[model samples]
Target: MATVSEVGELLIQKQQTITSAESLTAGLFASTLAEVSGISAALKGAFVTYSPEMKEALIGVPHILIQRHGVVSAQVAEAMARGAKYQTKADWAVSFTGVAGPDELEGQPAGTVFIAIIDDHDEVHIAQGHFAGNRQVVRQQSVQQALDELTNLLSKN
Candidate 1:
C-alpha cells in the first residue's frame, strides 16, 4: 500500500485534485495530505460530516439512503464520495464512514469502516474494512486505508 505522502506525490504528478467527506476519520485523510509539501496543488477541500444530518445537508446524501443503509454501510460511503466529487469538482473524491470506538454503532462493531472513492469518470469504488485497534488507531488506519485506495486508483490511470 502506498503511504499518504506517496499518494500526495502521485496526485501532484498526475495534476489531479481530490476532496474528502469524512465521518469516522473526521478530517484526518485531508490533514494527512496537507502534511505533504506542495500538496495544495492537488488537495482541494474536505467536508467533515460527522453527523448524518450534515452528510445530507452538505453533500445531498439522501436521508432515506442513510436510514436504509446505516451510516457505516457501503452505500452511504459511495454516496458521500459521489457527492463530494460533484460538490468540489475534484478529479477524485474519497469518503470515510465507520464505527471507530469502544462502542458499537448500528450493530457494527468498533473498527468497522466503509470507504469509497469516486474517480473522474464518476465511477465509484467501495471497500468495507474491519480494522482492529483502539479508537485513535482505528481512525489512523482508516485514513491510511483511504490513502492506499486512492493511490491504487491513481496508479491505475
Candidate 2:
C-alpha cells in the first residue's frame, strides 16, 4: 500500500488533477494529500458535503439518487465521485459516504462506508467497507482506505 505522500507524488508525476467529495471523513482525504509539498499542482479543491442537500447542491449528486439508495450506498458514492470529477474537471475524483458513528443509520451499523473513485477515463470504482472502530477511528480508517484505493487505481493506470 502507498502512503498519502506517495499518492501525492504519483499524482504529480502523472500530471493528474484530483478533487474529492467527502461525507464521513469530511475533508480529511483532501487535507491528507495537501500535506505533501507541491501537492497543489495536482490537488484541486474539494467538497465537504456532509449533508444530502450539500451533496446535491455542491457536487450535483442527484436528489433522487440519494432518496432511492440512501447517502451511504455505493450508487450514491459513485454519483458523488462522478459529480466531483465533472464539477472540478479533475482527472481523478474520490468520494466518501459512510456511517461513522456510535449509532446505526438507515438500519446499517456504524462504520459502514462506501468509497468511490472516478479515474481519468471516467471509470468508477466503488468499495464497501464495514470497519470496526470508534467514531474518530472509523473516519480515519475511511480516509486511509480511500488513499489506498486511489494508490491502487493510479498504479494500474
Per-residue lDDT of candidate 1, residues 45-123 (tens digit): 9999999999999998999999998998999999998889989899999999999989999999999999999887778
Writing each residue's lDDT as its tens digit, candidate 2 over 22-101 gives 99998998888899999999988999999999999998899999889899899999989899998899999999999998
C-alpha RMSD for every candidate: 0.8, 0.8
Pairs clashing in candidate 1?
Answer: none
Identify the runs in model 1 with alpha carbons over 4 angstroms from their true place: none
How badly does each model clash, as a count of residue pairs? 0, 0
Reference-based lDDT, residue 45, model 2: 90
